[model samples]
Target: MGMGVMRIPRSAFIWISLFFITLILANYGKLVADAISMNWLVKYPKVWVFPLKDYVSLAMQWLVEDATFGLFTFTEATRGLSWVIEQPYNFVRALLSEGFERGLGKSAVQVLPPLSWLTVLSAVIALGHYAKDWTLAAIVGACFGYLAIFGQWDSAMITLASVVIAVPIGVGGGLLFGILAYRHHWFGRLLKPALDLMQTIPIFAYLVPILFMFGFGPVSALVATVIYAMPPMVRITTMALQSVDPEITDFGLICGCTQSQMTWRILIPSALGSLMVGVNQVIMLSLNMVIIASMIGAGGLGFDVLASLRRLDIGGGFEAGIAIVIMAIAIDRLSQAFAERSTSYVHPKIRNRIYHRHPRSMIVLTVLIFSMVVGFFIPMYQHYPESHTITTGAFWDDSIKYLNINYFDQFEAVKIFFLKSFMLPTKRFFIGIPWPWMTCLLVFIGWTFGGWKLALMNGLMTLFIVTNGMWAKAMITVYLCGVSVVIASVIGIPLGILAAVNKRAGKIIGAVIDTLQTLPSFVYLIPVVMLFRIGDFTAMIAIVLYALAPAVRYAAHGIRSVSSELIEAGIVSGCTPTQILTQIRLPLALPNILLGINQTIMLALSMLVITALVGTRDLGQEVYIALTRADTGHGIIAGLSIAFIAIIADRVISASAKNARIRYGLETTHGH
Candidate 1:
């Protein structure tokens, strides 16, 4: 038998494909819907199902029972570890915000004196001065003062205590892992995928296992934050250490330096700049995860935001959100300023200045003494007066009400158009595809972009989703992420280009991007829900806003990173600005732009779990439902599905970037 096919133009083929899909959906819509809605087709057969949830529950029950029966001392071990971890957190928290408490019994406990709020404020100011300059000191003082004035001082301090505990753990573990990966080829290969998985997985995913193992509280939250924040630290550390000049290592060896001495004295000092960037990343990630951590009983400003959202108290939520933003800005600026200062060369004269000559210890001591004396005389120095506290919650609440009432029709129109015209159809198309066909399509694209390895990886991931009975939900997730990314790119790329070409525009746009990036991802849902109401569109809007920063940032970075020599060459060749950008800049920037796209997808996926609260029937909703119901099996699987999708994209995009670099002769022996 002979098979023959008619040739079709590329455009015609695309049109024909769309027509075929529409026809199938129209004709067999109910059947397709039923197949997706029913579990039998996608779910594992009863015999094949593993019952992981029951196993985990049973194991936990047995462990607890054993501990209680003294058959094992699991509880004692956990208690000891918990106590060790809690001590520093509690101490710092009390000093900064809680104030010390001492008593004979719970009912009779009396608050004892602790370090004054003014002392804490002065210490921050001093640290800021030591880290950067007087400007940063002012910023730090102002940020802390705002918290005290807004009556969020305690909540902010609780959050800060967690951060202080978590960042060091994250940075330390990351450095260890990074060094190991850098030293051993096999370990590096093994570590890369794990880091990618960790980085791409949503923070919420980390909370489930932590909650189960540690139970719910600040300890669990700290563990989750560390896990969530560590990958970047590791990747950055490895890259920084690996990027050190070979000549420097040879010189250290020639000087008879041992490995430990070389690492401590030479390697660390030389790589300090890159490592500082990693530190900044760790700090930011820890802050960002604080809110998600709150969901699992980690109380702080994050809890403030979460509680407000639950109560639909927009004013309160906004205030808490502002407090968070202020804290983020303070930390970010201080870290960045310090990083920059460390890399800079200071004049000897300036370095010898009285304040500069002394170590940070002297400055800290001076501030502490002053604060103590002031606190002894002034009661308000110990704590901001409650009567003097200010709030903007009411203003925010009123503003939101006014906007919702005044713009109801406009919001409704946008919601309806987006849902009917873009979201639903795209979602339907993805969900309607046969599981086998979807798997084949993914494999084909992966192979085309990255060869057999990626194809196999993606195929396995797709299989996992299909067998887990989450294909439909995964499709919905894909639809939401895909739409959000497309819209973000549409808005972000052009702005990035504009920013890249103009210095003034870059500064202005960079500030906006920074604000957006630092704002808690959860805060994005509030304003969108206020306008669009609860639905996929609102969720998409939140995801887009949360995800847009990277798109704009990377695009601008990519464009700017293009060699100035190339731009000059274009100019010398009589190329117009448009022609130069199209013919030269964009080509060079494509790899970075693609990276931005990859990041946007990852961010969008991360936001998925949070957006679940706003009503979206996807894998995010599955995870959220599992969390609420304490169904570990379902949440873990659903979260893994999201991770799998992200991994697949990351692999393909990375492969493509590598190929592009090779083609452009920009590939290097060492890469981050």
Candidate 2:
């Protein structure tokens, strides 16, 4: 009996202890409460709060002041760096917008000598054809044509300029760091957590420090976008390098290849598929940050969208949103095609074709030559005429007005029902939890998953939240994310299952998922506000729309990833489809689904600040307020709180997924 007792698994022991603790707390609640109320345990002093925000703000101020007034000359250095960065942006903007300026000062000659509209159109078509196929060419051409017709050429070009600068920097930096991390164990360990923090923190949080360091302008926006987009690139690169075949490495060693030679020729070439995927991710993230980047004076279509949102001009917002969507889709498709092509096996004969041999160079040369000739002849060809630009803003505005007039009562009822029956109650429950109890509960969960280390970490995080006096706001943010995730899961899982089980359904659903994932998250807020009105309900709706794609995607991926042999075994056993799904597929897929949930949660947290624009009393609102008020300390603290929450969720969920994999023998159990 003693031997058996000692042999109990740690998880079992932890659960049993939790049961007893719950019983004790239930039966003698006041006693436990009183014990926890001890000053050392519950009353965390203000002095205990790490004034990270204040410290960061002070450092930034010192840097700026010292650079300006002291001998350090940091400001001069930054300005010089800024000038270098601005050159690309200015050249691109000038090429796309002002064309060529020929005159000096007041008598300077200016000419709208940009590429002809037709020349630009033909260039996209040619590039798309080179990248993918004729379908892609048509799509790319149509998208550019839409921008021209809509008078969005200027803003779109500005965004493209920033992307052109940021993506390469992000991709290159990510690859460099990823290689470093993969090569050195200690560096990998240090880098992992930093990547996690970077990935989780709100976009606005990134802007605060960037604004301080770089000051406000396109350069700061570019820097922030690069930072935001780089983590995934780094993560993917590291994973690709690490996952390179061991046999290949051994073969390289046997062939007397140097480390550098083997890495460059073998590992990197083999990891092209993953590297390209990383590139795709970087492109998507760069585009996603365009709007957020506008917060610090990175003007473009994002600024237009923000202005429209502020003025409550649904039509204008919709137009700009459409432009953004088109841009996103064009970029996403082109990058995806490139990623796909990187891994594709091409015949040497076909590869030698003139177009295929020098696709990009040829396309650029052709466009430039054609544009110079045509632009010199036709003014409209050089610059799209404003008088001819399309305006659908009035149509959207009228439509929204009509809906508001006709459906105000119906919309109000729906809002009231959701708020009263779900949102408010959920909000209250999270906010009403006693801080000490909540902290203890989190600790218990952490202990169950990862022993004392995680428990202590979780406890410290909770303490940080409580002591910072943002418990209520934090809880509200949690509630919003929680509810959004729950609803997303409920809808997404079923849809994912349906798609996984049917080929036709999979194609259609996959397209929808792509659209959702690729569309700028901010775009969701417009239509959501139209239907729900602005409040917690609208914010929740917007978050759900924005965050739902991952749940569906992961669920489908997980289900589809289940082994064919497993399904065959069930069929051989005369099991029904339902039995196969429930007993075999779902159990095996749960880990992947959990991964999706983790992603969904992260995305929801990211959307929090954006949702604040629609009015929500959460950490997102706090960050937004800090931005508007220029309170760097408050913004940083609030953003860090959100990051902490995401980290906690990521750690706990990842541990759970690992355990699930181990139980299924998909992973080794040595760690456990």
Candidate 3:
């Protein structure tokens, strides 16, 4: 076998995969297809297609109107960086919803006034009781007083002034590209496949190259929410500065310090609690890219939940998707209570005699200078009046129009009993298979889970979606993200094994998977399109409630990370507790429930591209019809064929979880 590889015999590719599945169940499915003579092996042949979206729209119209670097012209250096990020996003949306004006329109002259809704609700209940306490300062003071009692306080304060300037420039450009990819090894191997193609593409394929390089408004939605919340804070600051503790870098190099004071005082204060969980995942992915950065203009509360979900107005888009889940649970519990707190430690001369020691920032700078000096003689303390607000958007559109006029045939008989028993027989058996025998059965199951370079990179990225014609909309985006990640891992792995063997059902299934992982996939398509209305069975019940919190937080953290001395050596060898939860905690929680079903199939293919605006043509409705026809080469070839089908289902579920931990020897075939 000269240089042309051979190595076939894995029981002769398991009898050629059981005679190619008994010749596709004897021609019914037709891998050996021939509609007439060979109807292009199950349909892909419109004369071998592949304009590749008019050669990526003439190389993005010559890189946005004839490229250049010297003496400007790449559209005048992106319109001078969209007028330098629209001057601090129009000075934090006019210091939180119109309060400062000068002299131009109506020959302006307000001067300043914005801080009042009782001084930004007493500075968000004194920064939620100085980050953590008084019951998270009374649950972020009743979710910042339900955005000024529901009239969605000026579009939730202009989406909290573009999430306070896109979370400090996405946590200081993810800690300066996580400290230049942890002090450069070829810049952490070219910054990890460009942060895994900026976290597997598709927040509307990052607004068609940020509306062709920041051309749209609100500084192209705050530079696509700071490049989609800076790649998980540069992969959580190069994994919290490469998990610090090497004897605190040899006691700051035996105290001779200075490599910038041992990387800023011994590895960034010993990696400030894992860089505050990457600043709470860049404040919940910049409030989950503010409802797809409000299709690139970005007003706030994701443009009032995309103009109340495009006027179907499910109670004004479920009160702007519950004021973006109460400002993402009060800024994810005040940035996780200011990264697990630390206060009472003063000593340096009583910390320079309590140098204005933030008694909740001196009571939010004395209630924002006594509500801007009583909002210059009370105009309802400077604005909170719209005829004294409070609106349940017509009481959630008259209680979902009286439950679609008395439970429209019991929600159309439970969406026709889960679409004629399981989403139209799993979308007609994945669009009747045969895309050349489902790309040679996923390239012989990625060459039986990882080999021959993942079966030639899974038969060339599943034959580039059948030569880019989009094989039946990428098999209806893999049967609606594999039946919404197998019904959210069968109802989130038994409510995560009853929240890991009951401590009151692990605090009620850990407060219902922490408020369903702080809502956002466009607020699970407004109460399942108001109790199931749209198709593909309301996009598989809003992608199984936005992929049920990573299958109940990776099955209650892989059955509470087993090994309590192997449950006391299986209770002294006479095991019980159902033989210690089915033979040692479900076979050591099957590699963390196969990494929580690979993060519930990458959050059910990123909530199936926002369930293509509640219809289902897939590849997220061709990246939302190439972001309404702007078409950056058909939205980057349908957002890189949904990032090459989430990188070939995350490399065939990480090589089938490393061949099931090397057939349960729990890994070790040679590499150490």
Candidate 4:
């Protein structure tokens, strides 16, 4: 293909190829030996390796020293500034343990005991009916009833409580940060990288740091969960607030409202709808963190799920997974109902008690609160505030031990066989390709799909990875994620379109997709391993499953959101349903489909770290190893490698989608 005005010379490309070839040959032996070790170095036995190690060590030490210095400064300066006070970190830990014990202990007695599971089911059903209708009520009640009968009520509650605490904290922090970002441009600029890292850094990669700083317990888990969950809120809040109507603010000011009044009464209320979505996200993400946090000693359903997997008890693990899905659905539906509810003022009617009273929703909420309070004061309900209600560490430990003896050997044997026969060969095939040749292939593919700008962007991304000594691992990640994205696109696009074509299917599929998107993918990993066994195939399968949601969701949305007039136009042309869908709907939705594919790729890569649990020598594994060993140098490099890939994909896809949108006149080109 011919180059654009900005293209590099053919000679430059040739020299670049020669340089990469020489670099590869220099590192060829070591690269092939471990395949993964090359990720840390451009070539082996190089003088730079020692310096890199030292640099990483020095950086970690400095971080530790700095943290220690800050802690000491605060403690010495303030009377109440110990780790508990200065850290106040211990406060959350204590609340999770001693606090829960005292409260639950007291409640256990006075709280009317376990009420028949039927009673609980009835209450949920009533709640659903009151909130929406019979259909929603049925779902809510059935999910709760399933949890109770399946013997997961306590674990589910434990998980719920942590989420109850973490969601508010994350939402509050995110809102605060977001408001700060909006009011101060420099602050937003400064926060951009921190937020990017928080959003893009794999969850597992940060667990080690969280464990190091807070130590293993509920508090560390809470902290990590909050950190992971907070970024989206911050980004959303800022975006939502920025999008608020200026005209409404002007009206508020015209009515003699003060700055604060305008902000609170007008800006905040208007932004409330979008802000609620952010809150929903916070809750979903916080719940999802339960399983991963379990890895570091936070117990609840997540720990149970992990425990079941370790024991190779698919039935038990699957049950725990279902409970998570149920909890996610219940919370999601409740939050969404409130978010979508319309608000209107009504004058009191003549003499009806209901007309004179507050809204029925408020009344119902009050009753629930009153019930909990009444339940709280019974002899069984009071707590001394120092006891934690439940512990799962021993349960998990025993389960792990039993599984190790019974199932681990078989797991290992299968893993070895798969790796030797299938996975290793596939991996080697990709690794055998010369770096320069691969670069050309990627650029060519990008150019064919979009244009030269995309090609250039893709080429530069590959160049960065190769130069940073991350080419091999990057390629491995690419290989697996590549297959997954292709599969996910195939499945998600069709499902999305089908759902879009039918109302009932849309609601059901939308709900399922929502549940899958919000529930932690880690919980699904163990079951996947049991069914498929661990290898690139297993990892790819997991990726495809986890990553499919975006494609389906975006495709459904893209089709459904199409202007009715356009569809009518196709109809007016006497186009058949199939012809309209193919020539108009699909073509128009292509941009969104491409965008979905982009997200699928990013999500697949996010799973890279989690898939390490199944044993893959990818960038995620490197990050995990770095975290385990506290190798900051290696960790930073690996983390950046993932970030770079995500950014590259994001840029190219975003550009292509934008191009499509403009070409189709769905949007205008801003600069041009």
Candidate 5:
């Protein structure tokens, strides 16, 4: 008698209605499109397409050829900037890997060696131990030792030289901008979306314009690397600075500090630990771009890997990839340890004497000088002799040969099974969706998740893709990324649950995921390309390997984050372990799990540009092709399509997660 009508929130009602209407209209519109000969609705027609990419190209051209400042044309200005950037790169390279020459012109001869391997190794080990403990020092030492022992020392140092130059620049620039944003609300408002867009745009897309401005050389590569690696640092710095305790801020003000003094003396010092996290991120991301940077003449180990990949030299690629991984692990762990040191170190004023203030630095300097002196007398110490170096290149190649010889049928079967069952079907379905219908559906989803603002954003972005005649390729990119993410989540979520519930499992899985996360995107492609040959399947595997860690991490964190009281209540209710997980834990953890999915999607798209090398024809390929042709328009447009897809998915899923968190009383947000 009391069930006349049920009340629903305005949001719930609109979304519910929008969902059904979108579904019906999207599907029915396809049939209508076919009847009306409206092929534009199915595939964006070239004749009617917008020339966004062309517009972008024209602007870039003007900058390169016509724009000027003061006495210099834009080209001259850019060349000057490039020259300035190269000075540091050259100095570092000379110090670490190339060494110096005496005399001038053709009469020059080798006058000094690059820092001896032993010296650099000693420096790294001492710094590691001083930063943390012997455990970390040992790890760092072994990573460096491997490079020398395996004949990668020379190339590795070249890579290191570039990273050394790039990290400081990236971290410094990001911090400066981040502080400006934090100090000015209006600036922060303007900066937030710019950072988002910068992060979303693939590194390859920017390289086109950068290559145009700076010309092909290490300077351009360094510039691209800095741009690619800086966004996270900026975001992190703003967050960390803001998170500083208010009491600390008040103390500095009470001490009659100026605004600058309160900031540098108080807020920044208190936020040092978190700022170190940004530094660590910058280090890792800079390393991740090593291979990508190589394309623009940043030559080093990245060039080695790239050459090997192009030639299908599995052994060569594997060896270089391992070297990259080792370098990354050493740098990553050392940076993390430094972050810890930042947390624990006493203030400079608290320490007396230079030795006490920088004991590690003194030790390193002492070892460095001694090594160089001894190395001058002993050529073996100055340079690793070719005869003494060991290599695993042939071994890796042989192993691949063995696998192919022994398991060719099995490998083929697995690839075919996944392609036939999951991959192709998803690809066909996504590509088959009418562009207009897909656009409408996404707009509805955005509205359902995040109200009109998100809906408008989604609609406009989707339309841009459609009107630019990129719908087919964009959908192909979507399907590849979508399938890869689905696969990663399927593999990662379960392991995450097991890890959450069992300590031993958690330890083992955590170790594995940590290693996976440490490997750069390029490294993932080496073995995958070796076993599977060049195709979408290989790309999918590589994407999965790259994306899996986040899914596992987030899912485990979510499940473990569930309140202990809830678990106890379930036990008190006589619930089974599985039942508690299936009901209470899973429901409460849905928001976190959704966020994990969002991350997985982001990672999958990031892999797209790298995976393009394996012969996939997604937007990544578009970017790569555009890069080669120096076609800024094509690259930027394609990159925008990919970025828009990722950003839209991120916004919708984030909104959904926020709603779920609020419903569970885990958040108290009152605004969208």
Candidate 6:
């Protein structure tokens, strides 16, 4: 399609064919070895001829021997860390115990009573009702009630606690780093690349290094979750703070405000809107990590979902999924309300009375009464002397056993059929193509769409995959992720446009998008795999389900953000609502819709690393294998390759989006 590319003769196909033939002949033995290596028969024979069992045992022995030595080395190095934390833990313990007799009235080692289920539900309903309107109140109440009834209340509470801890830490760290990045030119420059790497690294990659350093538990999970969730907030905060009006700063200076006061009172308050968006992002991402974090011993709904997945228990997984969704919705709405609350108009007279009313006293009085009632009445809420109180033992274990016995019986047949008919056939079709032929096709398509930059990127990415001996696996991954993205955009765009056109419907859809975007991917993966089985189709469905949210959100935002004057012009021209939407609105919102497509691609890529839970032979599978075997070299290379693909796509889409935005005179970034 390009002038330079068009001049090349199609007759070069003969030379291309011959070149591949010669290359294949030259590397026939290597190719045969690789093919044989990957074969289930050659790599894992039935204990004979190859002595597969003996070989596997020997490999396991080698791995365990190395792992034991590594552990011993680490233990020696960190021997003092245990002592350091013990000193602090003991110091606080002694102080609390000493003060207990002097009316502090608390023992450091003793467990306190938890609020009753009824009390907790009542408080949540009250808070939700107070936050927004009656609809929100009902949604909040129903969500928690369902969680409680489904036997996920305790795990849900643990997840809530972790989120509560992580969010504030993420927010604080983000704000600090944001201010640092904003104030120092060199620091910001250094931070940009680090942020890029952090943003693109797979969640599993974080697990290895984190577990290496912090070991596996809630703390390591917290560390990983915070790292992942904090970046967007940092970037947003820096951008928002940098975008603050110069005149406002001058005015604040003239008002006799110190630099610190100006930052606290003027800049931060003025930038609150965008900052709140960052906060919302943090909360949502934290919730997304809940299930992934479970891999590292962060117990909650995430663990339950994982357990259900391993056992193929679709119903149990569905329940946990619902709990995750409910939590996501509640937290998202709360953040949204907080962001909106600052803008609410307060009557001057009522504001003064409300401010003078000593709200803390009322809060303290309510807490005391609630505590008294809960401590006295609820059996399960009282501090238990033994292991049994409220329990979910049979509910979880029986579900797993039932599914293992009966559920996968029918599904396995279908899975085998699909694998034989569709999956294997498609894979062979792609792998049968000569590399040179594939290269030409890629170059031609890339040139047609995005021109030379894309062509160059395509060439480089293809070369990388081929050199790494993963070209076929990469193609399979591309096919699945591509299909998912296309499907998401198909559904999400029109739905978003429709939502944007109606105020009430926009509210309802907006809530759905919020919930979907935040719920953990593993929650969706189980039933998807159960329904479709563990192959490309199930993975694509899972990715599509999550990827659709960004597409819907951006399309809605783009349509709603369109200038009203354009609509009026269309109306004056005697255009119907349908004509306006088709002719005026869509054309105007094209750039933003393209942005939504970009987001869909990124979201789909994120899911690539996750779909490995259902087992794909993609880069994600390699990454997982590397973690299990502690093969850091292979893992890093595979991880970077995935990141390279993402970066290429991200750069192309972002460039195109920027071009469209500039052409349409649209603002690229929003300020507070």
Best by lDDT: 5
Which candidate has the top score in TM-score? 5
Candidate 6: clashing pairs of residues: none
Deviation (Å) of 477 in candidate 6: 2.2
Off by over 4 Å in 1: 1-76, 104-112, 344-377, 572-574, 668-672
* Native-to-model Cα distance after best TM-score fit, residue 66 in candidate 3, in Å: 22
Candidate 2 RMSD to the real structure: 4.6
For all predicted structures, in order, the TM-scores are: 0.90, 0.89, 0.34, 0.75, 0.94, 0.72
Task: Please count the clashing residue pairs in each candidate, in the order shown.
Answer: 0, 3, 0, 11, 0, 0
* Poorest lDDT segment (10 consecutive residues) of candidate 1: 39-48
lDDT order of candidates, top first: 5, 2, 1, 3, 4, 6
123 Cα displacement, candidate 5 (Å): 1.0
- Each model's lDDT comes to 0.84, 0.84, 0.80, 0.72, 0.89, 0.71
Model 2 TM-score on a 0 to 1 scale: 0.89
TM-score of candidate 1 relative to the true fold? 0.90
lDDT: worst 10-residue window of model 6: 93-102
How do the residues 1-672 of candidate 1 rate in per-residue lDDT, one tens digit apiece? 788788888957865785686557544654765767853443335565455556665666556446463553776666667778888888877776666777545655536546666767777887799788898999999998899999998899889989999999999999999888887879999998888778776666556656766788898888888889999989998899989999999999999999889888988889989999999999999999888999887799999999888888888888898899999888888889888888877666547566667766676677566666776687776667899999998898889899888988988998899899999888877776666656776887688778898899999999888777777789899999999999999999989999999999999999999889888988888777888879899999999999998889889998999999999999999999999999999888988888999999999999999999999999999888878777666777888889999998888887887777776667763552
Query: 33 in model 2: Cα distance from truth in Å?
Result: 8.1
Compared with the true structure, what per-residue lDDT tens digits does model 2 show for residues 82-134? 88888887787677655668777888676656556667677778778878999
lDDT score for residue 393 of model 6: 44
Error of 4 at 442 (Å): 7.0
